[model samples]
Target: MDTIKKLLAAGKFDVVLNQLQERMLSDESEERKDALYYSAVALRYLGRLEEAHQRLDALLDCWSDFGRGHQELGHTMYALGREETALQAYYQALKLNPALYASWDATARIEAKLGNLQQAELNAEQAQFLQKQPKQVVGALNLFHEGKLFKAERICRAYLQRNPHHVEAMRTLALIGAKLDVLNDAEFLLESVLVLAPDYNRARYDYIKVLQRRQKFPQALAQAKLLRSDEPYNPLYKALHANLCSALDNHDEALSLYDELLSDKVGDVAGVYVAKGHLLKTLGDTKGAVACYQQAYQLQPLFGDAFWSLANLKTYRFDESEYQRMQAAVSANETRVEDKIHLNFALGKALEQQEAYDESFSYYRRGNVLKRETSQYKSEVLSQRVDAQVEYFDRDTVARWTHTSAQHRHLTPIFIVGLPRSGSTLVEQILAAHSQVDSTLELPNIPAIAHELNGRQVDRKKPLYPYILDELSAQQVEQLAQRYVDETRVYRSEAPFFTDKMPNNFRHIGLIKRLFPEAKIIDARRDPMDCCWSAYKQLFAEGQEFSYGFDTLADYYRDYLRMMKHWNQVFPGQIYTVFHERLVNDPELQITNLLNHLELEVEQQCFSPHQSDRSVKTASSEQVRQPINTKGIGQWRKFEAHLAPLKKALGDVLSEWAY
Candidate 1:
């Protein structure tokens, strides 16, 4: 590969092609993907435009997100005197990777020749920006876009070692950290970059994104306000501010910003429409949301997000033409993997609505397979973590760390913990309907704290969190508990209690007990088959990586049950279990029992939680807005034939959960 790169750099295009061809004869490994891309580049530079185009088409057919492959195709198109095709290729390249300087340069030149002066100038500016970056930074950016995140991090860190104050290098490293799920390091690095380069709009923008990812909505909104103030008319900044507002539950402000962006005819028009649609959906305006989603797909027929949004409503049925469009989009060679995944899921839902069970399962399986290929989830790693938790947080260990002081006993956070798609959101809605209770989004604070306590070497054989909890002093415990309260205050109103319906919080039940001994914990349970099957079909925005594969999903459910059972035995009667089946079957009785468990007086509004106007930000948002029903109970039965692996993996869990 190094020799071929050297040959290409030396303009020995023929030699480069020869070497790649020889390597391709026997090397059918993953590196062949790179070989194909390099061969396309070599062919284009050698002025073999037709061959280059053919190679690029074949390469892209297998690797749709290959940004450099698209860039080389752009060059080939230009050499063939096809300016429009070349421009489209460049656009696609930049869509996959904005850091491609050559693509940006080519786009600028084409736009200028076509007399799109404004767009040409914007493209020129982007090209110039990339051209001005340090070579190492540019290389790191390319590697990052290629998904070689560790390599990119190494480059950025090596660059920063000598030039410690280089904001670009720091920002690039921070971007890698965010991608690697090291949000704490990413947030800190971005903060430092902003402190050193206060006027760096790009750094500030990145800082806001990191903050948003950390679930620091108010802080992110504050940064977004500063960014928007710096460029008040910038459509991207305005849209970002709107998103932050939506995150903070300022839906009216978010909708207004979306309207402004749309009316101005700038800044990702289709995306803005989708954002508006999401806001409408959260606000319980199904008709308006559906219309907005329809408008988005109408504007960009290949936009899979719009199609998925409609399907995710769980009740929306696709018309014949819409369904055909999704099929065509999924089948299109130009469709990227990310878009293909969304289209597959949408098609699955559409087929299911039409009662084409086999076809529906095929699409769902295809989407999950594609998604799982990209995920780094290991079921054993999660099982190991659960084992550590169970081992470390035994009865004696729990008793040792139990908060005895009344200093923090009043901090009664109602944690609804379970697996995703297990009706946790419904429990939250029911509790949030109570006058004394506030509801927040799936909070990330507990997980963030756990990550911090796990120390820097998180992947070590033994983690530091649950063990470290035993070593903390009373003051340290109080401070940590208070930090949770203070940090989460942004997400609450004047209610006496707030609900943190983070399903994964079940893993940290011991920590929760140590922090707030009097806190209410609810174990949201569902039929094992239903829960696993529901999770397998859904494409979570993030953090539910195990759901992308049936075996992983089943293993995760089993781990959850194991961990919950341990917590139950350690702190008997401290956790209330809410079976989703019981809740749906007898809402009033379940609601009464739930409130009684929390020692709260039942309100009439609790029985009619679907009427609450509070925003819901889960995939279950649409479902929870309607009356409770058994529609989702036996959904797995439709695809039972295709669920052998899931059923086998679930094993005794099916019988235990009475599925």
Candidate 2:
């Protein structure tokens, strides 16, 4: 220690670090562990988190069973922002030696980072039980993790009461307080964390998250500004600030920052470029948007959303040969089923258009198999959850619907519904292009309403009509309906009729009919397998567990089918099924029929949905932004060998759909 300190005092930190590295490579002595740990401390002081992760990883791999080695690696991984892996490492460390109480703190941090409250609490207790020495922050983390905010606050308060400077403990208490809806307590504790840490990354992120939740935008912005200044090298800090700016509608600033960021790119951040591309796309800069999206895809080869955006843009339309490259890019080592499915679907459409039906169908089948496994079972579960919720509301709101029908008026909203990725977004863009229709993004209110009525474990088969109808007083129905209207009204500027193109709204078809009978429900359908496969091949921003794995997604899709069938049976002829295949082959004819149903007199240019200067924000945005093309008809071919599970799970659904 003195040797390094003397070297550091002599302004030779670099030399000190270098000697430690040499010792790491040459020394088989136990002295190497000490050398490595000190070297890591120096690297962290230098703010070289990546290098630190590498050094720590090297030490841990060499001394695999060592508790301190694992703890050091976990800390480094956390600093490097690999939260999930950090938690696992910490857990491994504690298992190797339960007396390593420091692992608890790291595990707590990782659990919170991943938003796993249950696990966080468990780790917090582990910290308490294993504490060889109790400090001012004793038990606060565990209390907060357990959602016992009051007790957490007391612990933190007591810490501050004695030490009056326990910054980290105060911050931990404040974070929980804010989430627990005790804003005043959060304000007090966070102020303390900030004052003590001054530049703590954890405290800063927690503060911003809390402020954003409170909708204190200006304060959040200020904190964001401070964070970027304090943590200039942290890309995540910059991204969060950019996101906040976007949310506040400071597009010019956001765009400028994004533009600057693009000028000096980083690794594996396809999401940022995609965001920038979507923004450019919104501003009618299709060429620039496509360029940005291509950059994103180039950076992260297996990023499904990037490919979806690129495919959505007129990339392949301008250059069909990109299909092979896109396919190759998608088939990389880290290929996700969702990306592959979408790629294959896009490829199939491209090939089929080029008279490659056999190959196209091959892609289609591979994707279908993947789609079947991931979405099927989950879909059924969701339907049951919604049904149970509806049953609760039905028991209460039944009489209101009957009494309210006579007094209702002006129900002209168009719901663009169907399976996700079934061209709902495209269809809505076309309809929204009409002079009378406002094309809003997906509406999650229907599901939100359903969830609030009843939690998960819903019963779909039981008739909720009588009970639910009785439950909703006309006032309540009107209030709930009006809530949807109010939330959506912001997105509608001057269009006479607005479209809420939530594809999953198909599940709530009955509710839609009851609430707004006059509203048009356009059901967008692609080839059954194709639609399922496309969805399966994605890793969405939201919690879509089934989509990531094969078996779960197929089951989810089948449930969607089952629920839609039940919806059809109970409310016959309610939703207008717009086949994606039909639209792709004969867009003009289909659009005209769809318009006629919406009671809009056909304008000659509805066929040119691509020409409309509107931005499509969904996964289909890149593709739909361009002119309608037939390149995604059957995209399941390249990996057909691996799709047996999907076929087995979804054979009946595929057979019924004539695939």
Candidate 3:
């Protein structure tokens, strides 16, 4: 490393570049990125612009968030006299890392040349901000924004080692950690930063984001409240405060906050309308939601999310003009990739409602392709996790884990678990409609526990979770159980039992069973093709990555069946499986059977689950608000010709669950 550094320092670019190129082949992501970055820099200096561009492009292809690579690519493009393309690359680099002074200066120059003086002025000011920070800190900020989390982490840690108590460095590292989904690290770092510099509003705002990402809603709310108190008129803080309130189910308060923000004349009023529309939709206020969505559309027609929100209502019908606008927005070159995706899905739904199945399927397929290109989901990880659960939780292992005398005997929790878009939400609504049960939004406490059990070990090869289950003490198991009940209390009511309808809880049934041995666990099942088809078409708010691809969805469904079957075997009669089709066909009989499984009296309310006016927060929210019916039962048949890949992937499940 010293030799190559000295060679570069002495202007021996070719010798050092060759050495760095060989080192770039190492297995370590961080090391390879470092070598590749240095090599690209050397290539530019050696006037090998083409080679530098190729190397930088390859680096960014692997690590799309690498802001330095984008900046270098911009430089190479500029040197090659492709100034227009270079301007875009610079903008991309700055989007991830705002502190890229060189990129900013280059962008400003290009924009000035293009006669975009206003944008050039803005770029010049951003460059001045970067000039105030240390060069190393600016580099770290750029890497952090570019999405090179590992590289950013390294730079921040190294800088912190030298500066020891730099708050900005700590905050930057925390932001990177949050981006990397290491919420615990981000939380601790942000907490430390606040202790050092309590007046740092930006860090405090980031702290709120980290808390929210960790599902610490109460903590996030408190942080947001603090920010709002500090800057009572700040629209961003006000909006965040309203969002946190909504998350906590304080809908009335959230609505008031939104109203207050909407009245702010200087604010981006259209965004609040969209936010209010979502909140209204969640509260089952369809008319008000539609009005708010329309208001947003009127304010900003190009905002695809507004139209998507209307279509996501599953009941919204688009007029011809709305349809044409969506089509134009989708075809427009200036429309963002993200907006185009939403527009495509909305258009697909609109066409599907009109019975244009072929065109609808094409739109849906296009949207998925666009989304899949950016998705980082890998099915093998999910497959391996399932395999580990099956291997680790045999009958003997289950019995051993539950052999301890201490147990939380409370049956106040009813978990409705299944694939997203299965009948889980419908089941939850039915149970919640019962006089003895209350409904909570899909609580993250259960999965949060599993995440906690998967400790913070840095090694990637070691299994940290189910394997560690064998080592848990009886007291620890009891505490984990009690902790879930305690933490989830915020989402409960005075009703004896509350339903947590987290569909993904199907993944962690073993931990759940060991914790609350008597808790009612309903395995909501639907016809495989219908369920997978619904999931494929739905654009979930978050955390259903498996449904984005047909192959992944099929493999996930098969593994889910395997896990549920294993659980049923180990704990016979413990899980109640409800077929969605059967439930839809014979509501009374199915409701009676479901109520009997829970040891509750059969109620007419359960038969009319959709009439309860409860806030359903799933893709089936709208459907579940209507009477039990078979409208969605075999809807997959309409797209049968386009479902060959799905049918092939589903294999046995499709055949077995055929109508």
Candidate 4:
């Protein structure tokens, strides 16, 4: 590869091509990707534009996110006198990687020729900024965009070691940290970058993102507001601010901002439409949301989020035309992996609605496979984590922890914990319908607290979290409880009791009992086949990575049961279990039992939770908006033939949890 590069630089294009072709014939390994890419470059330099285009097409077919491949395609298109096509290719290249200065330069030239002065100037400025960056920083940025995060982090850290306090390097490292899911480090690095370069709008934008990922909504919103205040007309800043506002429940302001962006007719119009559609969906305006989602897909035919949004409505059905377009989008090579994932899931739902069970299952499996390839989840890691928790939080430990004096006894947080798609959201809606109960989102406080206790460790074999509870003084435990109440206050109203329906909180019941012994814990239980299959079909925005594969999903369900049973043994009669099938079969009797367990008087409205008009954010948002029914009970039966692995893995849990 180095020799080929040297040959190309020496203007020996023919020699470069010969070397790459010889290497490709002998090497059918990953290096072939490099060979194909370099061959395209050689062909373009030799003025064999057609061959260059074909080579780039083949390269991108296998590696669609290769930004340099797209940039070379742009060059080939320009050499073939297809200026508009070249411009589009350049835009695609930069979209994959903004670090591609050559693409930015080409785009700027083309836009200038087309008399788009503002866009041209912006492109030129971006190219100039990238050009001015240190070579290490530039290379790190490229690696980061190319998904080589570890390499990027190493380069960034080595550079930062020599040039300490360099804000750009710090920001670059922070971006890599965020990608690696070390969000606390990312947040701290971004904060440091802003302190050094307070006027750096880019760093500020990054800071807001890290804060948002950390679930510090108020802090993220404050930073977003500052960014918007600095450039009130900047559409990106305005859109981000609006998103934060929506997260913080400032719905009116979020809607107004979306309207402003729409009326201005600038900056991600289709995306704005989708955002508005989501807000409208949450607000229960099904008609308005449908219109906005339709408008989005019409504006951008391959926009997969719009299609998925329509499908996620649960009640929406795709027409023939819409269905055909989705199929075409999935087949298109230009469609990105992220978009393809969405399209596959959307198509699966569409086919399922049409009762094409076999085809629907195929699409669902394809989507999950694609998603699993990109995920960092390891079943062994999760299994080991659960094992650690079970081993550490034994009955004796629980007895000692529960004896710790409680601080926020007044804050009776109703924790709805279970697997996703296990009717946890439905339970929250029911509880929220009670006049004395307030419903919050899947609160991250518990997981966030556990994460903090985990600290930064080199070996995963030795974790500090559950064990740390043993050392915590009563005052420290009380302080942690106070922090939970204070941080979550923004998500609550005046209701004496508020529900924290974070499904994954089942893993941390030990910590919860230590902090607030009186807190209510509800185990939302569902039939194994129904729960596992439901989770398998859904594409969660984040987390729940185990749901992407049948084996993993089954293993996770078993682990959940093990942990829950252990919790029950430790705190007998403390955790309440709500069977979803029973609730659907006998709504009145089940709801009465649920309320009675919570020590609350049953209200007539609890029977009709679907009419509450509160915003429901889960995938069941649409399902929970209607009366309870048995529609979802045996959904896995449709694809039972394909679920052999799930059944084999689930084993006895099926019979144990089956209704």
TM-scores for the candidates: 0.97, 0.59, 0.83, 0.97
Tell me the tens digit of each residue's lDDT in model 3 across 470-528: 78887888888888877777777778888888888987888888887778899999889
Which 10-residue window in model 3 sums to the lowest lDDT?
402-411
Better of 1 and 3 by TM-score: 1
- 211-255: candidate 4 lDDT, tens digit per residue: 887678999999998998899999999999998888887899999
**Comparing candidate 2 with candidate 3, which one achieves the higher TM-score?**
3
Candidate 2: stretches off by over 4 Å: 1-71, 74-241, 244-250, 260-274, 281-380, 386-400, 403-411, 455-470, 637-639
CA RMSD of all predictions: 1.6, 12.4, 6.0, 1.8
Q: Which pairs of residues collide in candidate 4? A: none
Error of 4 at 612 (Å): 0.7
Clashes of each: 0, 62, 2, 0
Q: How far is candidate 4 from the true structure (C-alpha RMSD, Å)?
A: 1.8
Q: Best by TM-score, which number?
A: 1
Each model's lDDT comes to 0.89, 0.67, 0.83, 0.89
lDDT of 1 by residue, 328-410 (tens): 88988889999899999999999999999999999999999999888888888888788889888877876566454644456
TM-score of 4: 0.97
Write the number of the candidate with greater TM-score, choosing between 1 and 4.
Answer: 1
> Model 4 residue 9 lDDT?
91
Which lDDT tens digits does candidate 2 get at residues 75-143? 777777777777777776675555467888777766777798876896788677557434545466645
Q: After superposition, how far is residue 124 of candidate 3 from its true place, in Å?
A: 9.2
Sort by lDDT, best first: 4, 1, 3, 2
Model 2 residue 136 CA deviation (Å) reads: 11
